[model samples]
Target: MIAQRDLARAISAVENGHGSFAQAAATLPETARTAPAYVVGITGPPGAGKSTVVDRLIENFRSAGETVAVIAVDPSSPFTGGAVLGDRVRMQRHAGDRGVFIRSMASREAGGGLAPTAQEAVRLVERAGFDVVLVETVGVGQVELEVVSVADTIVVVTVPALGDGVQTIKAGLTEIADVFVVNMADRPGANRTAVDLTHMVRESGRETPVLQTIASEGQGVDALFAALQSARGGATNAARAVRFEVLRAVRDRAARSALAKLDEPAARAIFASLAAHACTRRQATDALFELFFTGG
Candidate 1:
C-alpha cells in the first residue's frame, strides 16, 4: 500500500495538472481496480444541510470501525480563483482521527461541477486503503448531477423548504439519485416533501428510498447509514463510471495538446471575437477547425 503522504502528493499533483499522478498511480498493482473502495456522493442545493449530513456520516462510518476519506468540494471565488474551503471547518473535529482523511477542494471552472481532478483524487485515496470515500459537491444546482459518473452510490439531500413540484425532479435528478434524503426532518413540511419524493420515485418505477433526517441533531442518521450500506450497485453502473472516466481523461488530454499547438495571440483573438458574437457552438467548432487545420 502507498504511504498516506505519498497518496496526498499524488492527489496534489493531479489537482495541479502536473502529470505526476499518472506515474504515481502506475505503481499500484492491478488488483487495486478489482477491490475498489465504495464511493458515496453527497449532493444537494446550497443551504440544504449537505455539510451537516456529511459530518454525521463521517461520525457514523468511523464509529462502525471503517476508514473513511472525504473530498468536500467548494465553489471557487470568481475574483481570486480560490475557495474558502469552509467544509473543512464543519468537519474539523475529525482532524485527529487517523482513520479519517478529509480534503477541501475548489471547483475550479470544471464544466462537470466537480473539480476536474476529483475522480483521480478519489482513486488516490482508495489506493491508500480507505474503506469508504465520500464526495461532497459545491451544492450548486443541477450541475451537481455529474457526481453520478464518479460515485457508486449517490445520496441526494434536500430540505423540506424547497416546495414540492416537478421542479424537484428536474435536472435528471430522479434518474440518478440512488437515495433521497429530506434533511431537517424536525422542521415543518418535512413529511410532505418526503411523500412527494416517494410518489415521484414510485411513479418512475424505481425503488429509491426517501429518508427524513435532522442532520444537525443526528436524528435519523442511523437509518440513512443503513440505506447507504445496503445500496446495491450493479455491474452496469460500475462499467459506466469507468467508461466516463476514461473518456474524460482522453478529452482533457486532447484539449491540452490542441491548446499547446495553438498560436497564443491568434487563439486569444479568435476566442474574443467568438465570445462577442451570437455564434452557435457548431459554428464555433467549425471556426476552430478552419483556423487550426486550414491555417486560416
Candidate 2:
C-alpha cells in the first residue's frame, strides 16, 4: 500500500513527467484499468455554482458507500506560481474522510481548458483506489471542453440570465455536455435557461439530458445521477476508443512541450531578448522567428 506522503510525491512526480512516476503508473495492475469508478467532469462559467454542485455530488456518492476522488483545477496566480486553491477549502468536510482524496491543481497558463498537470493528477487519483473521480476544470471558455475527452460523463453547469445560453453554445461547450445542469434553479431565469438548453440539444439532434438543481439545497441531484448512469450504460466502446486516441495526443504534446522548457541558459537568453525587444516595440514572434532561423 502506498502511504499518503508517497502517493502525494508520486502525484507530483507524474505532474512533472518524471521517469520514476511514469514507470509506476505504467506498472499499475489490470484491476486499475477495470475498476468501476466513473470519472465525472464538472465545468461552467465562473460563479455558476459549480463547486457547490460538486460538493453535493461528493456527498451523495459517499452516502452510497462509494469512495470519491476530486481533482479541482484552480487558476494559477501569475505572480505567486501557486493557486489560492479556494475550491478545496469549500470541500473541507471531506478532508478527514479516508475514502476521499482531494487534490487541487494549478492551471498554469496551459490554456484551451485544462492544465497539463491536471490530467496526470486525475490518473493519480484514479489509481489510488477511489471508486469515483470528479474533475473540476478552471472554468475558462471553450477550453473547458477538453474535459469532455477525459471524463466518462460531463456535467456542464450553467446559471440563469446567461444570455439565452447562446454564448455557451457559440463557445462549443454545449455540444460536449453529456448532462446539462441549470444550477441555482430558484433564480428567476433558471427555468428559461433549462428550456433553452433543451431546445438547443434538440436542435443539435442529440438526445442529451438536462437537469435543473438548486445545488445549495441539494435539489434534483438524484435525477442528475440517474441521467449520468443511463448515459454511461449507453456509452459505446467505440467512443472510448476515440477518447483514448485524443488523450494520447494530448499527453504526447504536453510531454514534448515540457521537454522544451528545461533549457536554463536558453530560457534566460530568450527572456532577456524578449525584454529588449519589448522596449523597442518589436513583436516577440518576429524576434523568436529570427532567433530560430539564425540560431541566435
Candidate 3:
C-alpha cells in the first residue's frame, strides 16, 4: 500500500507541474494505468451542501469496506493561493482511517470548479489502490461542466429555492447529470426543487434519477449510494476519456506558459501595441500566441 505521505507528495508534484504523472505512472504495471479508479464527481452551485454530501458518502463507502479517496476542490485565495474552505476539515472523522484519504485542492481561480491538475490527482490516487475516488468540484455554477470529462458518474447536487431554477439550467446541470441530488431536503422548498429538476430532465427524453437528502444529518444517503451504483457505467469509454484529459492537460500547460511570459519582451510588446490601440485585442492575443509557440 502506498503511504499517504508519498501519495500527498505525488499530488503536489502534479499540482506544481514539477513532474509528469506519466513518469510516476510508468513505475506501475499496465493494468494500473489502463484501469482507473471509479471517479464520482459531485458538483453544484455554491451553498448546495456539497461538502456535507461528500462527508456522508465517505461514511457509506467506508462502511461497505471500500477504500475511498476524496479530492475536494475549493476556491483559492487570490492573495495566498491556498484553499479557502478546506473540505478535509469537514471529514475529520476519516483522518485516522487507513481506508480513506481526503485531500483539498485549491481551484486557483481557474473555475469550472476543479483544480487544474485534478485529473492527474485522480490517477495517482487510483495507483494507490483506492476503490473509489470522489472529486468534489467548486460550486462555480456554469463552470461545473468540466467535471463531466473526469468522473465515471457525476452527481449534480442542488438545494431548494435557487433563484427560480434558472441557475441550474444555465449550469447545464440537467444535461450532464447521471444522477441529480437535492440536498438539504429538510428545507420547505425541497419537493418543489426536485419536481423542477425532474421536469427538466424529462424534457431531455431520458429518465434520470433525482434523489433528495438532508446531507448535513446523513439522512437518505443510503438511497443516494444505491442510486450512484445504478447510474454509474460498468466501464468508461477509455479512448474518449483519454482524449479529453490529455488535451486539457496540454492546454493548461500552454496557457500557464503563455501567462508566465507576460512580463517578457515579446509579451510586453504585444501588450504595448494593445495599449496604443495599434492592434485589436484579438490580433494582439494572436501575436502573443505566435511569440510563445515559436519561442520568439
Q: Clashes in model 3: which pairs?
A: none
lDDT of each: 0.81, 0.74, 0.81
Off by over 4 Å in 1: 1-3, 26-34, 232-236, 239-296
Model 2, span 1-296: residue lDDT tens:
23556557677776666755567565443344455568888888887878888888888888888888888887877787777767876687777888878777777776646666676677766776777888898875655566765688888888888896576467467767888899989999888888889888898887888889998888988888778667664563238537756786888886676457536566456667777764333555554445544555
For model 2, what is the alpha-carbon lDDT of residue 110?
A: 69
Off by over 4 Å in 3: 26-35, 165-168, 235-296
lDDT of 3 at 135: 93
Mark the regions of model 2 whose C-alpha exceeds 4 Å error after superposition: 17-20, 24-36, 78-80, 236-296
- The residue-by-residue lDDT of candidate 1 on 127-197, one tens digit each, is 78888999998876765567877899888898886866676666565567888999989889998889889
Best by TM-score: 1
Residue-level lDDT for 38 in candidate 3: 79
TM-score of each: 0.79, 0.76, 0.78
Model 3: per-residue Cα lDDT over 1-296, one tens digit each: 57788888888888888779986665444434334577899998888888889999999988887889999998888788766766776787887899999888889867677888898889888988898999999876655577877788888888888756555555455667788899989998899889888877787676778899998888989999998777556543244456766888899899999888889977888899999999999999789888888875
Candidate 1: count the clashes. Answer: 0
Measured with C-alpha atoms, the lDDT of residue 183 in candidate 3 is: 91
